[model samples]
Target: MATYEEVKDIPNQLDKYLVDVRNKSELKETGTLPASINIPLPDLEKALNLPDEEFKASYGRVKPSTEAVVIFSCKAGGRAARAANLAKTMGFANAKAYPGSWTEWAQKEGK
Candidate 1:
């Protein structure tokens, strides 16, 4: 899991996820970090079941190496935490949660 302070380092890290586990409206309105992807909490399981190309089509990228680290974020981290846990359960090797999430991110970004 990641703290607000730790989240600051994500941009500099390789293969880190900046997922927004928010709903579509939230995503459409506010988006996520620069390189982050959208994988709403509700769609996570089906997403995990998709083929790599479908994953790419859905989220704009193919699956990362199982060893690659990824982070999930949301309004206040609840959905992010759940999503991260689900990702790990679905066989992702290093899924983690950004506890501060978008609430903290927007605060940091002055949005």
Candidate 2:
């Protein structure tokens, strides 16, 4: 699992992928974590499976390798955890969930 602090600094980490599992509507309503990409839970598996070039064309970001550090976040964490587990099952050993997610992030950051 990932804590709010860890998620906050993900941008500085450079290689880490902070994936927000919330739907695009939710992100428009509540905003999203700094530097996190929107990859809704329902589409996450297929997104992760996309080839590198295709993934980049679709999401405008490179596809994370199986060993990459991929962290997931959602409204209150449920979907984030589910996404992380799914990534792990698909061979992403470093997948993790940000339990505090958007709720805690908004509270702490006063967004």
Candidate 3:
């Protein structure tokens, strides 16, 4: 699991990808974390499987290699945990879940 401090420090870390697994509606209702990419949990598998070019076109970012460190976060961390497990099954060796997630972030950041 990842901590809020680690998530906050992500912008300075080039090897980490902070992924928000919340759906679009939720994100619109309650903004996402800084420097995080939205990849709704439902679409995560397909998104990860997309070709490099297609992935970039769809997500506006490079596809994460299997060796890349991916940190998944969601509303209350449930979906993030699931997403991390899913990524691990798909061969992402360093996949992790942010247990405190957005709720903690918002509370801590006064958002």
How close to the true structure is residue 35 of candidate 2, measured as C-alpha lDDT?
A: 86
Error of 1 at 38 (Å): 0.4
> How many residue pairs clash (N, CA or C atoms closer than 3 angstroms) in each of the candidate models, in the order given?
0, 0, 0
lDDT values of the candidates? 0.80, 0.92, 0.95
Two-way lDDT contest, 2 vs 3, winner: 3
Off by over 4 Å in 2: none
The lDDT-based order of candidates, best leading, equals 3, 2, 1
Task: Show the colliding residue pairs in model 3.
Answer: none
Local accuracy of candidate 2 as per-residue lDDT tens digits, 15-60: 9999999989998899878888898999998999888998999887
Candidate with top lDDT is 3
> Please, what are the lDDT tens digits per residue for candidate 3 over residues 19-98?
99999999999998988999999999999999999998998788999999899999999999999999999999999999
Query: How well does each candidate superpose onto the true structure, as a TM-score?
Result: 0.86, 0.97, 0.97
Model 3 regions lying over 4 Å from their true place: none
So what's the TM-score on candidate 2? 0.97
Candidate with more favorable, higher lDDT: 1 or 3? 3
